[model samples]
Target: MVEAQAPLKHGGWITFPFFIATMAGLTLAAGGWNNNVIVYLIEEFNIKNIEAAQIANIINGCVNLFPVVAAIFADSFLGSFGVIVISSSLSLLGITLLTLTAMLDPLKPPSCETGSSFCQNPSKPQLFVLYTSLALASLGAAGTRFTLATMGADQFNNSTHQGIFFNWHFFTFYAATLVSVVGIIYVESNVSWGLGFGLCVLANLVGLVVFVLGKRYYRLLKPQGSPYTALARVVVAAFRKRKELQSSNSQDYYDETQKGQRNIVGTTPSNKFKFLNRAALVTEGDTNLDGTIKRPWNLCTLQQVEDLKALIKISPLWSTGILLCTPIAIQISLIVLQALAMDRHLGSHFQIPAGSMIVFVMITTSIALAIIDRFLIPMWQKLFGRSPTPLQRIGLGHILTVSSMAISALVESRRLDSARSHKLYGNSAVPMSALWLVPQLVLVGAAEAFHFPGQVSLYYQEFPKSLKSTAAAMVAVFIGIAFYLGTAVVDLFRKTTGWLPNGINDGRMDNVYWVLTVIGIVNFGYYLICACLYKYQNVEKAELNDTNSG
Candidate 1:
């Protein structure tokens, strides 16, 4: 069976690049809205730092669950095709609604008298319309991301194609980021805010259309495994196996069904109760009364569940890691918005847009991931004899995160000094170019290259077939929890300090960066600990003897 499947599932080599392109498109089309939320909220609602961050937190946290929910519906009742179609259609409505809201009620005016746009706030109607629109956009992002990645994976046929898709996932991520970077930095910053969001909205609609157009090339998979169910089966099987090994009871071995009251058909219990009878089952023995051979019980055994249970449990580690690692993306929103608001040179001439650094990371990293997987992986494998596993890649990524955070801490510490120095001169805080954040941003992109690949592969690899979607959902859940936890941390700090002078008590953006830097370092340590303690799934070889594995 393994031999047969191996020959059939070989994917294409060149198709990898296009796969990455598709992945980039899918990723950017999915989550790009996250970066702009802080600025969007502040501008639209005239909210303070904590309030805006809270909203951003909510959006990120909620977006993940939608996919899990959709995946559930797809697996159980609606087929994958039906689920995708409904989601895509809803996606168009959500994106268009955001565009309409932004255009109809602009979040910011073109010009301000003092040239400090934060000085003037929007009216209530303007605020309400913008937020409502953003909420719609978030809705679109959730459903859109759910189908997009899985759909992109559809382009590859395991049997007919080569290994092109192995790398294509990364490529697709960059392609989407290309649009996001351009939209946020150039389109949104240079044109109107509405245009930036509208750009993604349009891009998403295109993505939806592309999916609909290519439905034929894609293979629809049947969702038979539920990870939660698989895990339960494993636990039960393990205990039963243990009991048999201990010779606890001859009848207790596989006769668990017989332990309960099971009436035969036409008995006192009623005909319906016959369905529950295990005593009348085709009992296995050396030979039956009809001289038939002995047989093993099916489905309700311990060994059957092991393959899936391992994946379900191991997935949480990667998921937890992603949750902790990715929400730093919020820095693009919360930190950048605060930086721009307080930067002395934030006027038109010296202005550095909030989303530009995130754009920089997206553009640069997308290119790098293409190079890393295609060009770098092979070279390293040849040189090292054995290449790094996904787990190894993730471990290395934490090192990069530590460095990025350290850089942020240093830049922020200096910004504080600069502010104080300018205060002495009776100026607005001393202005620094947003360029200071470049190192951190660049490192983040590199870290992502290391982190996302290993983590996602580990996820798909570990779980049983029935638990695939559940494994996917568990990953999403971990990330969601991490984002929510990060939000809570920020909110707690704000409530404690913001009421005091300068909110954080340091009186400026520099202080916030200082705190984030310290927290990032702590998170780095925590992640390392988690990684060290984590037990990985042992790879199982295909066994034709077992009907299930076969």
Candidate 2:
């Protein structure tokens, strides 16, 4: 009798469709509620406009911030797939609760009359439920967002395939977000809030189901021991051996491969961060006879030492991202306010929803990303004989971001002029077209098309293999911090300058944009200095050398 053949393993291209569908559904679900939250709080919950904006910013920050913790959990304990399932379930529950709140009368306060002076605040229980729902949803969304990227990238082995996957991932993500901003926000504003949130609930369930269905076809990676521990060991060992003399001899360092563990070969310790090399020095009693570390915290491998050094080298570049993103974060919240104050009419029949204005940024970013990936990169490669590096892409983004702020300042000045000319400056909508806000939004979107992916790619390439998920999450963490910082900046302006009062119409909104413009230019100078001093840790040195030569 012939031997039975084992079943073929699943994964690779077989999982792409499932991952795309899941991503689209999740994006739609998250965006549907988040995009309209400020309006929801203002109109339904009877919250003040500025208060609602502040709440929305905080929520956005939480949604981005919690992902770093989720990434840690995935890397340290449960793998990405496990974390995703739990997180998606949490999201579904949150959306369900949110939808119920919309449908039920007791969950919200009585509807406020249009332009009413005294609106009833929500009861404490109602507020508690609302906050709880938001917390769960934000945490859930954050957990799945970037972890999914790491998971999808793991399904493929080829770098080119991984690159293509990321492009499609972002494309699907933005497209679904566009749908939520336009379609769901329109439903919530024009139709019924209940129906709109119900759609989000449905989307969440669908995304979760789709992801579960693809489990068998997924290349599920198990969690390696936490890389943070190794990093901590390096720091501890270095500090402990601070007084010890450094050695240039290779044999003086601990090599774990003698005991059958993998090791970094053919790379010498660099001169930079010379003190860290002490961590790997093989002093007496640092290692056992079997080549295992006697005390892991007292001695680390050369690879661990090098890994810490890489992170240290990239930290300055990492810090620049916070400043880089703060302006964009502030602009995102403020643009909605701007739209609310402008005439949002298209032609004679239809009026645009103020919350839906962000779709312009999403749409532009999607288109620009496609053009850059398909046309610009190839052309640059042909002309320069080397692909554009992340630093170059990020530098272009800085330029574009600065330009966008200047355009924003100019446009706000024009809108202020329109407001003043019509004598409707105090808390009332201006006759100026909302289309005036389009140029700045488009420019910012183009900047994102360059910098966002560049940052992700940069982190993925430079980070150690064990911290792959964490690397993907670094961008989210940056944006999260930026959002919080942006909130602080806005509060500062409100307290100090009158640039951003409760109603932006009566304030010097243009001045705020100009301030951001100056900040962007200064930040760009700082970024350039960091970029110049930085050497590639994981990338080919030849790329930069060749660029310089050309």
Candidate 3:
């Protein structure tokens, strides 16, 4: 029985690398949009730092949240194909608006265009249009990101497949980020910023078309998901489950197919459940204990509640971890830099591209994640009894962040010195070697590679099976917090410390490193306390995870 079902369930062209590749492309596109747009928004909006970061935080958090919503829809009503198509199409529309914003004559800011001092205040109408466009893009991002990864993982069935799902899951994940590194560093930083955004929107369009082309042969998992019910159902299932099992010995086992799903009922947000059979990714539809009549909801079933609790708690660790997002927020803050005391000239090209530091940060950080996991951890495990946990990796990641900030402080202090010596020019000019940015960017990327994977893995594993999409959504939530906090801190700094004897404010692009570096130090300490409390799972527990997902 095992042999017969195994090959068919696990291996096929659906597990083909190409299918995974296409899915990975969507992930890259979503992340690329999240990443590249920040730099431009900050520049265009003349926004405060915290206000700027709110953009990234809001977009990423909502993107993460919508997945749970989409997952429910997919499992219950919309099939995977339907959701993927809609999400991808929405992304295309959102990106088009962004493209229009970018392609404006002389590429104007949200409030005012280049070479114009006409209006001091852009109305709510303009802001509303921009927000509307961004909001739609965010919606598309949230749904597509959730489904694409889940779908990619679904491509392999663990019971009979030779495809190493665990490996491929992370492999596709890392591969997608590799593309983000390119988008951040090369596309956004190296190319015309508008062109970078244009590509992001275009990628979504192409992805939708291609996904349609391949739809026929794909094995749409019979969506055996749970309904989008409220938390009360989880409680009822536990109570009834104990009653049914009370008559049996502790060793007694019940096949999931033997019982019907626990009955659930609800309205809008507040819902409830009655005694019903639990559900699974795929399950036997029989409702009676004797396996008589068969019926099941095509929604995510609560298969493993005990395991899910452990997973959901890990989200706060990542709550503030996507530090690369800060740079995204900074693009808008650049206008502040220009207003404060920066010199935009290259200082002979060796000067750092202060505005573009995040690009290098994301690239190197992703590379570091690959190196630490594949190479460094193996070597360390051989030498020591332990391989690094996600918490450990996060700690290591923060060290780089802290260091990046410290370096920024030193750089800013030096710039201040140069200005005092009359060697430094104005706020819109560059003073130091662009190479000075390498360490900060590289450190940021290293931090990312180390923290994000395990953090994401922890979130998915910790949340109850039915809530994978929702818990994964939490990873983006902290980033939102981080974004808001970062922006707020910057605003405060600019208003308070923005001024120096030379008329420089802390918002100067060069001086902003000082801000990031210091904030990184503080963020690192907080991450330390959080990491200590974090509980994680081992590789052995993954299979049983299926047994308990409800």
Best by TM-score: 2
List runs of model 2 lying over 4 Å from the truth.
1-8, 157-161, 258-268, 546-550
What does candidate 2's lDDT look like per residue over 1-550, in tens digits?
Answer: 0111223365688999989999999999999999988888877888767667888888899888888888778776888889999998999888888888899999999997623577798999999888888888888898899888878888887889998999899889988998999999999888999999999989999999999999888877767666888999999999999999988777777656755442435245778899999998878897667667888999988878888888998888989999899899888888887887889999997889889988888888889988998999999989978788888888889989999999999999998888888887545789889999999999999999999888988898888765665786788888999999998988898899988776667789899899999999999999998888776767566667433211
lDDT of 1 by residue, 1-550 (tens): 0011123233334334433443454455554556666655545445555566677777777677577766666655564556666765655566566566557636443333322335566667756665665666566556545555554444455634423443445345555565565555455555776677676666666655665565444455555433355345445434433423222223322322233322122122112222222222323352235433233222132223334345544644654474445446445544564455345244666555565557667755677677787888888779865556666677666677667766766776676677666653211334676677778888877877787666766666666655554455555666666667766766665577652132221455445555656666665666566556555544554321121110
* Global CA lDDT computed for model 3: 0.54
In what order do the candidates fall by lDDT, top score first?
2, 3, 1
The superposed Cα distance between candidate 3 and the true structure at residue 302, in angstroms, equals 11
In model 2, the clashing pairs are: none
For TM-score, candidate 2 versus 3, the one ahead is: 2
Cα error of candidate 3 at position 338, Å: 8.9
Best-fitting candidate, scored by lDDT: 2
Residue 36 in model 2: shift from native, Å?
Answer: 1.5
Better of 2 and 3 by lDDT: 2
| TM-score per model over all chains | 0.71, 0.92, 0.68
Error of 3 at 533 (Å): 5.9
